[model samples]
Target: MATDPNGTTQSDDAIDPVEEENVSGRASFTASLLTQGRHRFYTLSMPSDVLANTCVVEPRNEDPEEGFQRALDEKRARDIANYIDAGMGTIPTSIVLSAQPAANLQYKRTNRTLSFELNQRAFLILDGQHRVFGFRLAKTSLRVPVVIYNGLNRMEEARLFMDINTKQRPVPNELILDIKRLADTESDAEALMRDVFDLFDKNADSPLLGLMSASERRKGRISRVTFNGAMKAISDSFSGASAEQIYDVLSAYLICCKSGLREYSMEDLIVNPTMFKALMLIFPTIAERVNDRHPSSFTVAHFDEIVSPMFQRSKRAELSNPGKSPSLLVDSFRKALRSGFTIGGGNAV
Candidate 1:
């Protein structure tokens, strides 16, 4: 460790980006830049228990696009709720409004009375907005687990959001697409999500992992091995996929067959055997569609299109013939993959 001329130990602040290369063997300037933010202590944490759901997180009206998007999500929320209920799950709760607060509103904890600007705007949730909204509609207790941030600037929040996500291990394209659709309307969404992600991190040890066939086992192993190195691995895998897309496509090819439009859920899609089996079915189709196409040309819409045929064919096998195999539907999916598709992108705005 180097010492200052005055004898204090040199810290990250003392590193001279102008003169050194980093331990990663990149120019020291790049590493030094990352450490610069270390001196800025902006984060504050409070007990997850004390956090109240007082701030009605309404959609911000400043952005017209936000309102339209919120309206669209509202449309989807009902469908999500139906699916969650059928599957015996719950979605996340929601606030009455959505916005960042300049600071958290002060309130009497037990009495639950607002002490500050009782009528003023409160902070909208950045993440898990749909869950909060859904749970509120269901008339459950409003208090839940959350990480409330003070002075949450939009750009900085976005940056912080992505930063926190990078802490997790990588995921498959289909796997990421599947979980991304989890609506706030699952029966016990927070718990379901925890169970789902817990299973995902633990690998194939969970019941859902057993859906893998011998061939799919080999393929999944290869895919995970190939993607173990980078963040882009998860992005690239999930880049051209979506929760709806993966769910619709995979629901057709299932063998053990648990997840369905009737039983659709964050928990079911992420950890149910039917969902895992569908992933096995989608991957190779994705590879064929790409055919080594332009790198930028890759997208989640392709994955959605890959299974459109299955979705179209099996809208309600529930009433007509629920027991037979969906091989015909799977064949239709393969054909759809061969024909190619055109769909758009994800916009969580």
Candidate 2:
């Protein structure tokens, strides 16, 4: 084995007969020399010390499947592939972190490649950096689509990177949910549900909730805008209301079934104040029969067991007191719910 002055072996491991023939047939490439056919050129840097970091061999990369997908997403892999294909054997190497602020993306050279890998290193994400980084990694294995620029200016590189990622909006939430497992494999679904309930409690009391929840669901469809607006209104008690008032509103809704959770469907609630009172009565009655059930989206069995009896009692009481006010039935139902059945063991149902 013969050693080059650069400490690289010129042994059979490094050079094959075909490569030797090619080297003999062609003159060594010089960075300072360029043909005049094309006016465009890209600039890259190398260390003034030659043997310190001798670049050798063709462009190559070794990465896994997951890495490839992430690179595609960030456009890093694409940029790298493009740079190599444009005949840049060793593109400029910057000993700097990534472009984003507060990022520490240091890079260096290994073999003929300009890389970011270290013996023992960790990467801290700064901003939209994931794309270019991913692109760089992904391109390590594949070829890229590159549009060579004049002098390979730093601003020009920045512009190209920005154009690849910034122009597109993110994918939709439902689609993201479909890929939720990829984002967080160890997620807690039950905890997520509890958080949702807590959020509901936080926003259940508002005229907007009374207004928008009462708004018709259009043709079996509810839009994101509609849902978000309605939810936002009650989030933090109309924004300026006090915590006590917020609690009062929440408690009233919770106690009276003014919010959802009872067997009350859309048809049951067409208006506020009146329909609301009816709910206050009916929910407590129906909520009684279940063993492990909380106030939730009820099925047909719930309606049969709990709701029908309360409705009959309220109706009869209302009719018997005909000379009384128009809201007498609702009043009676509320009273019934207030003085409702037991909670545990044989006392329940």
Candidate 3:
């Protein structure tokens, strides 16, 4: 026998048995009682098997009166299960659940033990359905921290569900990348790109000084994501080149564009991500010409001799519209470069 918060009493046999025999057993565990405002709940460590058997997930129902959870993402559950099986993963966060009045939940504060009947639908999972499903799939028994709220109606359950899902802010992608870089967990190419971006942003002599935004977007600055994306495109082209060597080449190239490309300002052409990516797209072709002329030199004087003709002869109308997207801008730049400087063995116009 147990008394609910509403002063209703029910015997053990009053609980309706679920159709499945494996999930029909009752659950008893030591838990700490906690209160917030007028609401009271219990916290305990429940075995993964017991949690899977006793709890139910009701997906969002067509009727506003029922179900509050989203449908199970089976792939996400499987991924979590794999991570658990790998034996290195942990889920420290507590799963939130609500017991209906019919569950006959009783808390004995003397022993700090909470007991409840495990009927067909004893508990409604407010959150962590995917994790519970993962626990079900895992072979190793894990004791998951759980918070159980007693006698919550469908409406109350739905409100709590929304509060948890909507109110919490997810971590930003830029912060994740920065954390990975600090932890030394990012890929080799990503590390290289970040290092180069830092050098460009901090180096006084670099053309891109004070022009990179590492996290938040700023007016008149290129974002770290855009810079990293552009660098990824050129990583293969500059495969064997050291970070310093790549920095020098980029520095020399930008200086030439700034000095010779009198048609457009550097702010529109170089500081803009789309135009910068387009410029990088044509870098290998220009570098090939520079290499052909001066095999041992990648200095500003050498890059200028090869690239200045293309910059001077390029039409303002062709290069002015950077909003046409990177691929379109690449085509426009390629056309301008070809018209200004002949390919293969031909001299610059």
Which candidate leads in TM-score? 3
lDDT tens digits by residue: candidate 2, 1-349: 6677889777432332221111322211111212344433212232212111121111113334211112224355356446544654443332211222211222222222122222122222112233334333432332111111223233444444455447757766434433454546324532232233234434654322333321233332322233333233345322554445433433444433322323343332323333433443443344444324645434445444444444433444243333423256556665554443555533222
Candidate 3 on 1-349: residue-level lDDT in tens? 7776788885432332221223345567767889998888988777788788778888875344576688889999889889888998889999999997656888776667677787657788998999999988888777788999987777788888998899998876666666787776899888888778888888999887878777756667877777888888877778887788889888898877767555466444677777778878878878888888889588899888766777666667656767848888777667766775456766653
TM-score of each: 0.29, 0.24, 0.72
Per residue, candidate 1 scores C-alpha lDDT tens digits across 67-180 of 211322664545544544465654333222233453343333232222222222445554554554454344223223333444445556555545654664555444543344
| Candidate with maximal lDDT | 3
Cα RMSD to the true fold for all candidates: 21.9, 19.0, 8.4
Model 2 residue 56 CA deviation (Å) reads 19
Query: Which residue window of length 10 is worst by lDDT in model 1?
Result: 26-35
lDDT of each: 0.36, 0.34, 0.77
Off by over 4 Å in 3: 1-24, 37-40, 52-75, 100-106, 116-123, 215-219, 256-263, 266-271, 302-325, 341-349
What order do candidates take by TM-score, descending?
A: 3, 1, 2
